[model samples]
Target: MPENPVLDPKRIPRHVAIIMDGNGRWAKQRNLPRIMGHKVGTESVKDVVKTARELNLEVLTLYAFSTENWKRPAIEVKGLMTLLKTYLKAEVQNMVENDISLRCIGEIEKLQTDVQKIVTRVIRETAPKREMKPSLTLNLALSYGSRSEIVRAARIMAEKCVSGQFDPEDYSEQLFASHLYTGGLPDPDLLIRTGGEARLSNFLLWQLSYAELYITETMWPDFKGESFIDAIRDYQSRERRFGQTSEQLQAE
Candidate 1:
């Protein structure tokens, strides 16, 4: 069992987002195919979800597949889909038992029909479990772009402005945020990228504007509970000012 931290549980982040990277490198390091690394990485997902829910995280979003990921070879993509179906079927029961519900972000329609069916079943089955939301982004990105999301939101706002529904004075930061896909979800406090990568790679362009980042050299397949906790502790040590000066923050 992992040791519990000494701090008040209230200090834990309400939402945590992760960019699961380095599957190919994890497999290549051992002269194995990248697909194997992804398979093992799936197990790590189960481990992290179990630990996180126990620790009371309200939301966890995983960058499982990105719009850019579709550029990869066809065989590898099919393997990932198969892995998703298998993992979801097995874990959904456990998640429901533990009070964790599921959600999907990004373009989920590109997934194979069977895979979609399973995902739907699990989501409905786990709907009653509300302690945590476990979300996956299939970024099928079929054509997802952050710039595009912002432009789309602006267009909607423009339309509203032209109509009688929106007042110019009501257009605030909160109003713009409500127009985002992640509008209702709490923004990620800590964004993690494994396999030593430090860049955002076009992930969560809007939501991560104020997030603290943690990069790990450990490949995604090897990312376990201890590694995850290290990232959380690193996050806890930082100060999130949201644009206030250090002196002003201290005064508050």
Candidate 2:
């Protein structure tokens, strides 16, 4: 895909997170099964991942499934797991070839046993080597929820303090953040949500505190590379002062 000529290469976001939405709606409008929407959405995933790598993004986090998704119909849930397994099996080799490391952030153990095995294998296979640093890290949020993540981190901190391994008085935002699933990764600089959604939907609440958000009406399946570049172009046009006035930012 041709790069967007308007993008300032230096201003590209290092980390980009996406909430892939409207899959079911897309399929419904086409008179197809919801799973078909998910299936087609994988192509968009591929396109976005390729675009991010070409742009030299450090991390690309995708909200694949949420903890609440377990409440969905059993058949749909099962199909999603099967699709996830299939995607991992088919994409692991490509990921390795492209120097993209796969990482999952969520209650991975909650997935089906077979799906878990494949996920583990993909992560292991795509692990970055000392000599071959990964061009991008593809982080999938499977069976994930931000509130639960924050609670889990809090519990870990409490346990550490009880064991005398941590001092409560020394606690800081950094200390608390280190216990979260995304401990070592940089926070997303840009978050894009498809399907006209205006809500966060319990995704990366803490990490997205200061991130620029881009919402699109296009469904996930149709969000190709050009759509992604459009988001980047819009992002570049904004002023992210991070709580400072224009004068203050310009002075820096």
Candidate 3:
């Protein structure tokens, strides 16, 4: 059972996405190096993953690094990559033990060779097998940009059409989504952004078309299981009518 009294277990979101923000701000507030905040943020990630497993969440997508993040100082980018590598290496065994499958969505080729190797290894090791059905799928969005993803999918569809493998008239929302990086995954049910940011930050623009948004002032380093539960609780309070009227939803 969930620890939160207000959270309805039956109403839990199947897929939840988060944009972890404020690492630099958090470090600056503490007069520490920005990398320090990122380092501590890894601990929060562990906590949230544990919580997600406890809640039986089907999928958790984390916005780890964006394509635009490459514009930051070289040192910071290096530090972030190192942190990512360390996190994956350290968490692989834990994820396997916990039956959490690891997945990545983005331009993975853009990552360093060593980081790519580790990512590939982790994904291979944590993949769900016939006898080992994963309890959760943890997706890390690295070097990801929604616009670029959209364009990539479009290019693939166009090429298929030109090759006579696909018809131009076959383009539909469902068919287009099949070409996306998140083709096999459901769209996020909720999107949680830390650091009080309300914008999407070029993350999952299409997948988050109808996801409930939860913005928090808490920094990524400070967001833990309790904070996550609070977001879930808030989500359960809302009535997601999609495009239907409240009366129509009630009638159904």
How far in Å is the alpha carbon of 146 misplaced in model 2? 0.5
Alpha-carbon RMSD to native, per candidate: 3.4, 1.2, 1.4
TM-score of each model, paired residue for residue: 0.86, 0.97, 0.97
Worst 10-residue lDDT window for candidate 3 reads 1-10
1 or 3, greater by lDDT: 3
**lDDT tens readout by residue for model 1, 1-252:** 447565457678877888889999999999999899999999888888876776688777788877677788999989988888898889877876777777766656777788879978877887753544443311112223466567768888889999978888889878987886567778788898999988887777888889899998989999987778878888888889998988999998
Shift of residue 250 alpha carbon in model 2, Å:
0.8
Runs of candidate 2 with Cα error greater than 4 angstroms are 2-4, 131-133
Clashing residue pairs in candidate 2 (N, C-alpha, C atoms within 3 angstroms): none
Error of 1 at 153 (Å): 3.9
The list of candidate 3 runs beyond 4 A from truth reads 1-3, 131-133
lDDT of 3 by residue, 55-173 (tens): 99999999999999999999999999999999999999999999999999999999999999999999999999985658999999999999999999999999999999979898999
The parts of candidate 1 lying over 4 Å away from their true place are 1-7, 129-148, 151-170
The candidates, ranked best first by TM-score, are 2, 3, 1
Residue 133's lDDT in candidate 1: 41
Best by lDDT: 3
